[model samples]
Target chain A: MTLGEQLTETSDALLELILAAEDIEQKEKLREQFDVITESIEKLVKENVKKNSKEYIAVTHNLNAANQSIKEAIDDLDKIAATIMQVAKVVEMLGKMAAAMP
Target chain B: MIKKITVLTLSLIISGCGLSVTQREAATRFASASTSVGDFSAKEFAAMRDVTIQMNTKDIALGGKAKINDLDGAFDVDDVAIRINAAIALSAYGDLLLALVDDRQSRDLRNATMQFEDSLRGVSGRTLSDADLDNLGALVYNIGGFFLEQQRAKALKQIVLRSKTDVDHLCDLLIQDFNPTGLNLLHAVDNTSKRLKVDADMALAAHKDNPKSKLFAIQAYRLADSQRTRVKKTGAQAIAVLTALKSANAELVNALENNSEFLVDTRLLGVKMKNLGLALKVFSGS
Candidate 1:
């Protein structure tokens, strides 16, 4: 497969994995693994392209687009984390009240 | 009459004219909870605040190398700036709690109670019927207990209000700063990875064509490896921080939910105050 195609496939898979990851640790691991794949793709693109060539500019643009999608996915994950934190705070408060009970 | 006067004078001298040490100690103890409760709340808030500040500082430092000349660096810097702003919000929350604990309201309440106790001593040996003396003692007990309860309720309310505010601020920070920073950091890391991959691939291709390019390819691979390693380290740290924050947030929520127990029953205080009024009425023979 072409580098762009590989990246598109990888990005799709990572997004699905991130969305399905219920555990914070699991999500983080997925993100790290995704980073490795993207890095490899980036290397491939760079190796095959010549400066000012159509292939070079096209791959860069594709990479940028893929990165944007990844950012959106990460943002979704972060939102989930923040929600968890907020819920945790509420639970903590309830616990304190319970402890205070006579 | 002479014998009675002599005994009364001796009793007055022994008890410091009705202001006994025991009475003062009891009164002080009753009011001391005001400060103690405030101190406890402050300590708890500080613990959470410290952890939050540390996380934000780390994020900010991670982005500090971002420069306009370097796309990744510039992006990272902006991400860090968002975290710093969130940290400031967290700091504000901490400050409000500290202020609530250190406020003079508690001290003022204690001093007023002490003065009231001192004044009450003046009525200790007044010429009154047995019924009147009993009423007077009851009045003192009712009023003193009521005062203590009042102070406690006030302290509790302040703590609760401040705590709620802090929680709200935390939520806001998460939305405004934490979420955005996380996205930005991810983007920067992805961008960096892509750049490093390009270099490594280019070097490898060159080496395939010319043996002299082998060293360059090796260096490129090493650099890419280092970049991946850095990402792993940072990812681990971020996870750890978020975990701690999540835990702290949970604790806070539990505390808030159970806050009903901490709430002072002002109605009970009202009853006590009413009893004081009734005791006074009996003493007045009305």
Candidate 2:
């Protein structure tokens, strides 16, 4: 699946989990993370298309190679499709887990 | 038992012998070895020995400017620099013993290591004085002696010695003792995750209906972010702890991102996660 499609699916899975959340406060906080995930994806698909160019892809790839000079470039938020995924994973782990969710 | 007593008694007596017969011998050997370079005399060695002992004993006994001045005298004056360097290490040996002995019982091995390290730095350009560099040799002996006396210091020293080949092995050794002996990484992970659940509950209470509340988001984010940041910092520290002060060989960010201490220090997670809201606060100039 495309990165956007994959992210949307993860978002849906997390939202469905959130809906079952018994704690009203948990529901609200999950709603915020849910909003963050949606907003980040929206930012990617809308305002950041030029950022998805091969130049940005190279930055994330550069991190894997230990190009010491490019550490700052690697930190560029738009360059990190993989990191978005990884952070989504952290959110699922920290904010929502399949095993813990009803 | 008798041998242990003999060894302990001998170590104790040698610790007290002051001026150290062995150090005096080393100074004589150093002087003879370097005579081709200069005629280093026993008097110079004795002068260094006296000054270094007085300086360090005072340093250990009190500490601060008085200590710094004592070393500065040896540092600033000429000709005796080499002898003074060895003497500093020798003098520090007495302090080490005072800390180790039963009544004294202070365990600042790091301080002892640093003093010897300074002496080693000061002596770098010169050969041992005619007295066989007795003071330096005796200092090396005492450092090695602590290997037998203190497990943590010895393990740390060994980690440095062994890190050339197996750095992960060094980290593994740290994991064994960093907590109590039996409670380790696996336990740390399970316990922290469970505790995170409780923190999550608290965050739920604290964050409910408080989207606009600056304090609430900061608290929640800090609670969440601490786990990640602490793990990263300690992983960096473990790598750094092994490295010489000037060197930066440890690319330990990933290890910190991945490790156990991060899990235990979970309070900061909330602080860090608040980064997003804090950034928003800044952008809005609030």
Candidate 3:
């Protein structure tokens, strides 16, 4: 089990023990300790999962590269579309020339 | 001789169009489904932060001791921005994929071809025969569509190959971030909310003698229970969507690698994304 999971299981066990404690002072002491353990788990989890870690930075870089490659592909497709239109324009010119001849 | 050459070229273009029709459909579906996943994640992350802050407020009201540190985690603006930005980048990547394969350009070419055919009728006082006009339309469509499809297939192949590693890593990282068992964001939120629930229960136990105090404690526990449910459900949906995206992307990459026409069955990914959307709408009430 992960540290978070282990800590959580321990915390739950502690809470159950607090419920079972017969002495009021002991119950209060266990509750305070439970609070501390839970907080430590939260802090540890947050520290372990850094949002701006190096891996995330690398992902951002990869996305930039992918975006550039996609942009180039779109540009190339646009040029091909232009060529298709040019072919149509040439065909139209040829038709008009033939019509004007006879 | 020129007529024969023209006929052969048209034949080649039309045949090329047939080759990638299924692949094109697969690329389009992958793009749409993955985009939905990205958009879902970005919204979920922002909502998670808001929910954490709301829970923290309730924590302070319930006399919980760890409010300040938990609230600081929620308010880390730069960290949240990085997470949200990465998700938006993912959405943008999917959009670019769609742009590469969508038929908007070819549709425009069809419109232009019709206009050109209309102009020819007025200028020469000689209307082309219906068959001639039909052939002209078919030729324009096939050539335009073939080139576009061919390029789309090539670009899709290049992109899937080049970006596969990064996409896999990002999706896996997001899944772990939302994982319930790990030392991740979801775990931190779950811990805070669980602590609050415990405090609520203790409050209920402590005020057993006074009716008014008992009523207040009951209401507090209910509030804690409701918010905890929301956080858990939303976190689960985030993980589901990211998991679907990772599998879908890997399937797409594998198809491309094999140089096969059939890419992937996006039905499962589509259903997962739709479910995530429904969960978000219900949880956020918006």
Candidate 4:
């Protein structure tokens, strides 16, 4: 591979190895850079016509999921807590009234 | 009158709804068990001890030269001596024995007493048969250091070994071996996995952008995930049971958020609670 192509592969590989990157937009920028380099090289090699397809699809899916799941988990935790308190309020009123009768 | 009832009802509702797993258990137990250790008193503890002392003294009397059988229940051998001799077991037999040396008591003093009584317990409890006692008697009467040299050291070693055995048995009683509420043990694994995952995340956050540390964090995350996968799913049928418990005792005026966990679970308490009911399964700490 040419020096530019090697540098591109190294960057993409480094990017893939990082887990749960907090900023998906930052990752996408780095990823798009890697893709441009890969697209240029594959055209030169006359490799598969679907050059940047596989990795391009994966990074897109990951970027979307990471952005979505973090917010979802936080919201889900809050919802579970709110439901618990609501249940508690209902039961407490019923039980206390029953407990107090002559 | 209705206003008073409404306030009381509301207060109970808050307590019932907010009580934690441990306190709830204690409340249930308080409703059921006896008020105190009426039968587990010092005298009863002492009598069981007298039987032990009797056997020890009996050995000393029978073995040959001097027949000293004047071993009445003279347990006034000092209170500290009593505590050591009680040798209160943790789980029948455990590997690590916790000695109760009161803060006021000196370390050497407690150790000396523990070693002495532990020897007495071992000799009386095992190995020294009638014939052995007859021989031991001759040695105790005629020889100096007979109690300390052979009997005491042999007994200490034996007691230490027994204490180790006790610790092992107690460790086996760790509640997580089986699910706290069922035949399955997944609850323990779930709690463990969650704690590990949190720790891994914290470690990763601390390490931040370093590649090596991040790799370690990824490995830690995988380990935590593996721990989670080891557990099967939980069944929430017990939630109703807990709900029923909350309803039953959910009355009272004060709402305490801090001690909520202590309020909900069924546990054996070492000492009685400051306030109690008629039924509780108050288990000793040991």
TM-score of chain A of each: 0.45, 0.42, 0.73, 0.38
Query: In candidate 4, what are the lDDT values of residues B240-264, reduced to their tens digit?
Result: 2222222322220011223444333
Assess each prediction's global lDDT (C-alpha) against the native.
0.37, 0.33, 0.72, 0.32
DockQ list for all candidates: 0.02, 0.01, 0.56, 0.01
Model 1 chain B weakest lDDT span, ten residues long: B175-184
Q: Which ten residues in a row have the lowest lDDT in candidate 2 chain B?
A: B245-254
Residue range with the least summed lDDT across 10 consecutive positions in model 4 chain B: B95-104
Candidate 3 global Cα RMSD: 3.1
* Tens digits of per-residue lDDT for model 2, B132-159: 3334333333433333334322222232
**Best model per lDDT:** 3
Q: What tens-digit string does per-residue lDDT give for candidate 3 at B1-286?
A: 4345447657776665332555566667778876776787677677667767876776676666645665746336666677777778788888999887777777878887887777666565555665575567567766686777678678878887799888878888778677765667667666766766666666666767878866765665666566666656766877877776777777677666664554444547777777777876786652
Best by DockQ, which number? 3
Model 4 chain A weakest 10-residue run by lDDT: A44-53
Q: Candidate 2: list runs displaced more than 4 Å.
A: A1-102, B1-172, B175-198, B205-207, B210-220, B243-286
Candidate closer to the true structure by TM-score (higher is better), 1 or 3: 3
Give the alpha carbon lDDT tens digit for every residue of B1-286 in model 1: 4344444544444533222333222222222321222232233223223322332232232321113333333223333433333344334333333332232333443344344334333443433444443343333333333333333334433333334433433333232211212332322343454334434444444347666565655554454445444444433333333333333433333333343222122213334334433433333321
Off by more than 4 A, model 1: A1-102, B1-70, B73-80, B95-183, B204-223, B243-247, B260-286
Q: Which model is ahead, 1 or 3, in terms of DockQ?
A: 3
Q: How close to the true structure is residue A21 of candidate 3, measured as C-alpha lDDT?
A: 74
